[model samples]
Target: MQNNIKIILKIFIYQVIIYLNSILILDTFHEVRGYNITPQGYLSIIFCWISFLPLILLNNQKNPVMVFLWLIYITYIIPVSIIFPLINSASVYSIIFVCTINILFFSSILFFRIIDRITIPKLKIPWDLYKILIIGCGIIVLLFVISNPGLSLIPPNIFKVYSVRQHFKDNTPLLTMYIITNGGYVISPLLLLASLYIRGPIKYLLITISILISYLIYSSSGLKSIAFMNLAVIILYFYIKGTKSISNSVINIILYLFLTAGILYLIFDFYDPLIHWLRRVFFTPTLNTYYFYDYIYNNNSEFTTEAPQIVSQIYYGTSGSANTGFIGDGIARYGTLGLIINFFIFNILIFAMNLSSKKVPFELSTTLYLPFVYTISNSAITALLLTYGLLALSILLFLFPTKTNKIPL
Candidate 1:
């Protein structure tokens, strides 16, 4: 009873922090930073609270993937979908209907257990062969990057990355592009895992090389996510490795980090990084919800089936892509029906991840799973599964040796 109460209190506190953070963004930056807030009446505020109550059900301890998904949804998606829309005076009916779909999609995580009934046939590959294959792929990817658009073309700064990214996409062969992009996802996690379970200077060397390669990839491809991908995986590996409980530990860590950041900001009045983080992590991703909805539903725009970056640029007459969360992307493409389709597709991906989890360590599976979950915040579900190689990642997880021990030299 005491533990349950403590968990409940933590959940409550976490939710309050998120709610307060939304207020902080609104109150602090509404006019000064051009946040686009136009408050509706107090009744809409009540609706946001009611809409967010389903998050408590998200405290399920069974799946770490689900916990990470909920963390992003609660900390970012809910505010954008619910609070931001309300403040913007978007149609209440539209907001409620779309937000309900999001809640249902999140709640369906409970059904992921059904995936356990479908057994995946184990593949028997020698560990030596597997390592060779991963390393060989990594080498090939590096060669591809070096040859196609040599490091001489490295961008000056992250802001310049898009032009270079666009150039790479436009100039590189589609098939080669596919291999190089997907290979990064496949090889980086394996490298991180190898470094973790394997002990010695070799491990240090591997990680150092991985970080450098990530930096080079970012410089060449203009993808900021790729630059820190290995570090994120390493952090997640040790984080879950030390925890006794996965779901609660995840919630507590997120809560404490948020609180710590908030406190530091208050004490020091440090707004630059905090504002940037808020814009990236919260404002831009969520605001895309409003942008897509208004574009499609209110403006009577046709369902978009084109590249999101192209579509967003066309819509806004802007240079940058208004990359949006999956929910927003669905709305942009399919209207009300897009919501259902994206939800179903996302659940399928989760089911695949859940099935693969049986063949790997839970921590390893969840760590590998983070990128896909995180990507859903700013990419389409179709792009995530197909273009982003999440389906391939699931198969990779399923094939990972069930018994991971120290790497023998």
Candidate 2:
């Protein structure tokens, strides 16, 4: 009971820090961009504060799924709430509506008791079949990489050649390659290998090599998020397996935060070439959200063009294009109504995944769920579906379903 109270208190403190961080980021944006916080912006911040209360009050901090959800909230939703309003002068009505949608989306988790009662057939794949599946995926990835020599195997060179947004623009070939190679073949096998790492010394050595190779592939593709996501998965796996303590996890998170801040400071101080690169990756989505509203409200134009096209217009004018974050995409594609619908649907999907994780083996569940958790902030519905679909396929092929008396970490 005392431990639970301590966990709850830690979570409460973390929530406070997240709230303060959101305010700090908003103030920094205002100072840099000279955007005034309107009444709607203030209302949005209020709503954000209110939305977080349910998570805290419900008190499931020790639950891994709940912990992951809270991590997502802190990492993405909090920053997004402030950043979006700072970039776009949304009306109070729209702000309130979006906030209400967010509240409903998160609050739906309280109803997971109903979801937990639904049962599906247990899947069971043999160990031999799992090995075969991993080997097959590795071969496929190798072939794909050989076929596409344009894909760099070095991080710096890849970043030099392609902007983050350019990777997702209307390049069907590159998109197809990503879906086939990275989404389909690479991530699942890497996760499986990572899961096997805790088995023994030889397995640990082999998995380390596999992880290094996977990191190179991901970094070479200029998607730093993939590398970070994999790292998070590995860390969470250790924690789940009881190989790492909560204190260690907290320490690692703090170290990562400090390292990220130090890197950002260096980039700012040195005026490195990467300053513009980082700006384009981080700020373009927020800027585009504002431009999207400008086009719709000020220009009195309908957003008939697809999200990529709209983002392109916002960033590169008439010719170039890029993908925006899920919220921006939702708003652009369907307006406030669309955004509300998307949020609700996304929330339901995540809720189902969370419940399903409890029913499966820890290794399989972690592999299947981590990608979705990491990518939810940045990916559109279509992109998310493709990635999850591929992951589901891998899960079906490699993971044996069993009724485990062991509780989820």
Candidate 3:
């Protein structure tokens, strides 16, 4: 009874804080940073704390690996998303919708798997599945890199789509959001390789060298952020299942947190690879490091009163343009309370994922958690499945059928 009541109270508080955060056009005191943080944001923090009290009461009675698998998947979509409606922009709605859509997507995948069970007239998992999956994963990483290198979380370079500075409706800033939300490409090959190989110090060294080489000239905030994020996800999966070695467990957790601080620093730091590559692709210097801060702080107060614009730039090919603020700016919707809720949600989910992961074997757990590492690299946690290729390869575990051939088992 007490546990249920606490959950009810937390839910009520979460709703109230969410309501306060959505006062974009309604609130009179919104623009003042210090003023809005109280009623709206602070409550989110309070309730966010309240929500975690149930974890202690809950027990993991199911299969550890399976439990982690579910937890990791849920961690990505629920924690922060349950409150996404509180954000002032349509993108927040989009993020929620995306999570819903992803759930459906995975459900469809699950449904397909179930269908396979019933309609198995003649079943043959692909014989060459491992090679195909491995190569496919590498190709995916390459494609993501080639296609979306500029989709950085706080891209120093300002891209003008159709015209300059005025091409977007709501001018929905894509770069920061892209970096902040999506990171499914960077660690794909690394994780895939790790899954396929018997990992040793040498393999890790080589993988680290590859990452360093990739980011040697320009610090790949997106790639590095995403990489570490994948790692965190892996760590969570291991802990949840009780599979991790004690030292490995502590190291992974620390590595995950360290990546967070590093990515935050990168978001503030400047890097110019285009200039280095061509020696003169410089149309302009990078935007001010403090530009996002200025926009949020200066424009947030009621005194400014200007709505977000819908202009476009003629440079790229778009009908919309946007100003970049904090990609994590949605935290401000509920004020300081909401900020706490938002942060607490992330940490709690991470903890949940960690606890659940302990159910899976250490060897199997890395595959599950690899994407969390990449998520940290760029603050992109929009997808729980950070690495697109991991799925393709997981399919190969069936294709190759490593059933009784367990080396470590």
Candidate 4:
């Protein structure tokens, strides 16, 4: 009981620190950028903290999902709230709206936490089936590399040039190639976990093959998110396997910070690559969101179409890929209420799979679910449905098989 009280008190203090840090950072950034922090922005930031409190306080399970979600929130909010104002001063309304949307998103997860306790049954997968799944995924990954040689090993010079251009002339990959490459995203996390568990020459072979396949897929596509997702999986697997404690999770976060800082330093040295990458990762989505606001308020237009369409229509002459993230897309299409409704459904789906992971910790379900959670923050719903969507369905079918399909004892 005393230990429980100490844990609760520690978490409470941590929450306070996070809240204070967010406010101080926002204030400092606004002051430095010659902008005044609005009352609405302050309220929104506080509300954001409140929404996340349930997850922070009530999560006795020490699920890695909380860690990933916290990281995503910090990464997303710090940049948009603090750094983004330097580019352009967003209106108080826009800032508040974004904050509220985040609150809803967090709330959806909390709702799942409650339901997860009651609804999810314990799940188990046979060892033989798990190995077969990993090997089969490995074969498919190799096949992808062999079939799409041109797309698989992109030249560094070409990548550099493409990065500088900030737009690929023929960015639309073949349907077959796209599908095959996505297999890497789906299985890379599984391979990492499998490497940790499986023994002998087979283990080394799986690790080598996974690394090679991941390299080929990321090199061919030049999508930073996929690369980042792969890296996150490897890092997270070690973090989970090594120390399943809150303190260790903090250390893992610090390590991630350093890794991110190192990448940022490299990006600065190679500004052209950074520019192209940021154009897709940060600027385009943000610009689209801003344009979306203008379309509705300034132009007296209703947001009937998707956020990407709005971005494409307003900001022409780029790489025609106008995929704003889930936040932007959700708000643009359905308004705040719509975003809440969609997130509720999304939360349930993700949480169900997450429960399966907890039942049999650090196995196939966990491996499959990690990549999905890592990438879901930044991806559009439609894009995820197309890519990770197929992966999730496969995981459900295999990882959590029906009793009828269960292997005999």
TM-scores for all candidates: the values are: 0.84, 0.68, 0.36, 0.66
Clashes of each: 0, 2, 85, 0
Kindly state the number of residue pairs that clash in model 3. Answer: 85
Residues 1-409 of candidate 1 have per-residue lDDT tens digits of 6766786677566555655665667667666523536555454455555545555556556565566566666555555645554455556666576567557655665555445467776676565666666566567767777777535444448666777777768887877676667656756666667666556575775565565556666677777777667778888888877777777676677777776678778998876545667556655676666667767766788887653564457545555677877788788778878877777777777777777776567778778777775577888776677667788787776766666433465
What's the distance in Å from true for residue 129, model 3? 5.7
> Pairing residues by index, what is the TM-score of model 3?
0.36
Better of 1 and 4 by lDDT: 1
User: What lDDT score belongs to each candidate, Candidate 1 first?
Assistant: 0.66, 0.50, 0.34, 0.52
Best by lDDT: 1
Residue 300 lDDT (model 2):
66
Q: Give me the candidate number with maximum TM-score.
A: 1
- Kindly report which residue stretches of model 2 are placed more than 4 angstroms away from their true locations once superposed: 1-45, 56-58, 61-65, 82-90, 149-176, 181-220, 226-232, 243-300, 308-312, 315-323, 355-359, 387-398, 401-409
Mind giving the per-residue lDDT tens digits that candidate 2 earns over 1-409? 7755665555445434444433444454554432333323454455455445444434333444554455455445554454555445556754664475456546655545455566665455544454455555555554554454445555554346356325533332654456444543344445444345235453454454445545545644555555555556666566666633433354246435534654665666642322343334334445555555555655666655475676565545555555555666677677767676667766666555654555455544554455554455555765665643534443442354344422122
Model 2 is weakest, by summed lDDT over 10 consecutive residues, at: 400-409
Error of 3 at 366 (Å): 6.3
Q: Where does the lowest 10-residue lDDT sum fall in candidate 3?
A: 280-289
Give me the displacement of residue 44 in model 3, in angstroms.
Answer: 8.2
Residue 151 displacement in candidate 3 (angstroms): 13
1 or 3, which is superior by TM-score? 1
TM-score between model 4 and native: 0.66
